[model samples]
Target: MPEGQVITVTGPRPVSALGVVDAHDHLLIDSPGMPGQGFADVALSTVEARDGVASGITTLVEMTPIGLGRNPAGLRAISKHSGLAIIAASGFHRDAHYPAGSWVYDAPVELLRDRIVTDLTRGMHPADWHDPSLPLDEARAGAIKGGASYHHISHAERRRLEAIGAASAATGAAVLVHTEIGTAAHEIVDLLEAAGATTDRIALAHLDRNPDWELHAEVAARGVTLEYDTIGRTKYHPDSVVLDLIERVAAAGHLDRIVLGLDLGARSYLRAYDGGPGMRYLMTAFVPRLRRRLGDDAVARILIANPARLYAMPVAGGAASPG
Candidate 1:
């Protein structure tokens, strides 16, 4: 197979390619004035991305463009360059991206909702941070993401959540929330349910941060997929917390309710910074350790089976045995 080239999912089952879909990855994310990262092919080479894809990553959900100042053209270019099924997102992030005087900050809830719905219904042009002349159509985005960062508790943040709720209700696109503090996951669930967004259409991101196994269960019971995406364990948290939560969630007989991801971004400085582990941690450290502890079947359930169901991807890829 050629590097950076996509192969059709042509297995006997309805799915193709390798068995992993990285549900959360920031292929190109940067603040303003930084030239961004996704467009600079040399910065994080598409070759590296291809290498990762070759290592079982069949699909990658890039989630930084719309609100983090990601450019649609760059995303399209990178998608073409990588040749993987790159699913991009369209939505708003926190105030840092919105800033104080930005239009996104003061936009009415309905206006924001319209933008999200339009993007979901249409598509997005994911170039660089401020690239002009990007198209907004459906061929670009596969879903919409709403939350970004667990920082401030501002009206803008709340409005973004409301917009996300409204967009999800209107478009039926799956939502990924960046849980704020300890309240974001629960609060988002409430707001979405109140707005009549089904739990299955929502994913509770970073449920491992709060570490309340019971709360995790509650979120799962609502039919929402609790994304256990702390795969980069050494970053932002201790390995013990990741291990503990995994065991706790599994021991509670709810292993089927989890989805796994590394949550890596282009801006992350794992090799430079001492606090975080790089993106390869999942396929390298986590998977082997998971198999060692939980056996091959349990590992397969979390890595393969659960994520497919969570993302609504075809589960008939390799086999159909229930987890």
Candidate 2:
């Protein structure tokens, strides 16, 4: 693979090709943690993805980690059908997303680390590593996904984080960590850094759930990206809250560290399922408002330039194999 390219399901492409990105989102996810809420239909996903594309999104970073219904082959099909660049994830989610007797809970650090590296450099396991004998999917995972508990990191979660950090260190892949309601932001970064992942390659998802500008500014100052995906999530708070936080963070001189996404992670969150906001909400609804508040240059940076930097695979050895 060449330098300064993003590893998408279709194959590697130049960073410049990723125009206007949704830095965090999910196209296929099925987890016991959210009962009866998983969406796996590739046709519906392609429909939703096309809507997003029509609304001005060029790429989507699918953050459904392993064992949480991450279908790489299905993602590839959706990408081809929808004309959307999809960057898949490899790693694990929080403890709640896995079952009590699942192998993810007991897998050692080395096994977990190798799985992630294989997903990045080789291909993601079609069965999410449930059956390693199965052939690998042609679509490769471009980024790593890991999560922490609410203000705490469990034993299993800690092990997974260690593995994620090691894989990131070895491959120079970007990592996206799910922060529960935005808790343990600094602590998550600390552990990943201690495990050899650099702050620049780390992004804390759902940081807007906390909505603390001071904390966001501090984290951004540390060279870590802050992903705000609460757009149109009225259940959490109004879009104004996120807008205010972005303005404050930008004022604090960390605008370059901010990225935006809708994070429509559930079936009910998609318009194809007769849901509200859908994937188009970010670009069609909130982005116009964001442009009014911050002007086109800042919005372009948030929607385009920042994601290009955050999701770009390291221009070094260890990136995923070309599809």
Candidate 3:
């Protein structure tokens, strides 16, 4: 692997080698908590990544962590078959995504840290389900993700965040945290920094849903990356609304701290499920809108430069080791 390489599911490649990147996305999301026909399909994911490549997206960050059906082998297959640089996540999502009494809730901090560290260094098969027959996965994680609940960070989530922070500090992998409606963004940063995580290596996802310029500027001033991923979903806000927010943040002199994502997790967001806009929506549509609004230089920063820098692991080889 080369220096300044971005870790993919297959291996690490140079940052300059990457083209455009979707900073936050869930290539496949399958948990017991997700509906049966909601949005978990390898075939669909293959098309998603492949189609994005057609429109100039060279990389994708898969934000589905452990306990959320983070199919590492599935991700590897998608990357192999699609020829896309895919980065898999290792950590926990919101507590509601898991069943009651799951190990994520009750596991000791050291245990959680070791599990995430192994996923980063060695492989990404999370559990055996009390059965000895299941095998470990060969695909390794490129990033770590953790999250809190609505309006409050629970004790369990905090413990997991601390463990995730420790794993990140050890591995130098970027941290993607789910902010419930964008609350506790600063608090999350404080906790990760307290646990020895790097502020520049942290990306707070879904803050665009909240759409607060002052707050976003505040967080970006702290050296954290902000990912605005809810594009093409008119149910939220128009694409221009997000573009406007980006303009505000850029004008605040924090342009380097910004990134983008498609966040096409829902079944309806999939073209295979008649989700028309598809994964190319960002590269094809919103990016053009951004270019028109913010010029090609800013476009390059958000889609190419920002993500490559943020997602690069501290110790780069192929997969990062917890050394």
lDDT of 3 by residue, 17-36 (tens): 77788888877886666666
Ranking by lDDT: 2, 3, 1
**Candidate 3, poorest ten consecutive residues by summed lDDT:** 126-135
List runs of model 1 lying over 4 Å from the truth. Answer: 1-18, 32-45, 125-134, 148-153, 233-235, 270-276, 313-323
Error of 3 at 290 (Å): 0.4
lDDT-superior candidate, 2 or 3: 2
Residue range with the least summed lDDT across 10 consecutive positions in model 1? 1-10
Model 1 CA lDDT for position 195: 63
Clashing pairs in 3: none
Tens digits of per-residue lDDT for model 2 on 1-323?
Answer: 12388889999888888998999999998987898899999998899999999999999999999898878989999999999999999989999899889999888899999999999998889988999999999888899999999999999999999999988988888999999999999999999999899999999999999999999999999999999999999999999999999999999999999999888888899998788789999988898888889999999888888888887877643464422
**Candidate topping lDDT:** 2
What ranking emerges by TM-score with the best candidate at the front? 2, 3, 1
Give the candidate number with the greatest TM-score: 2
1 versus 2: better lDDT goes to: 2
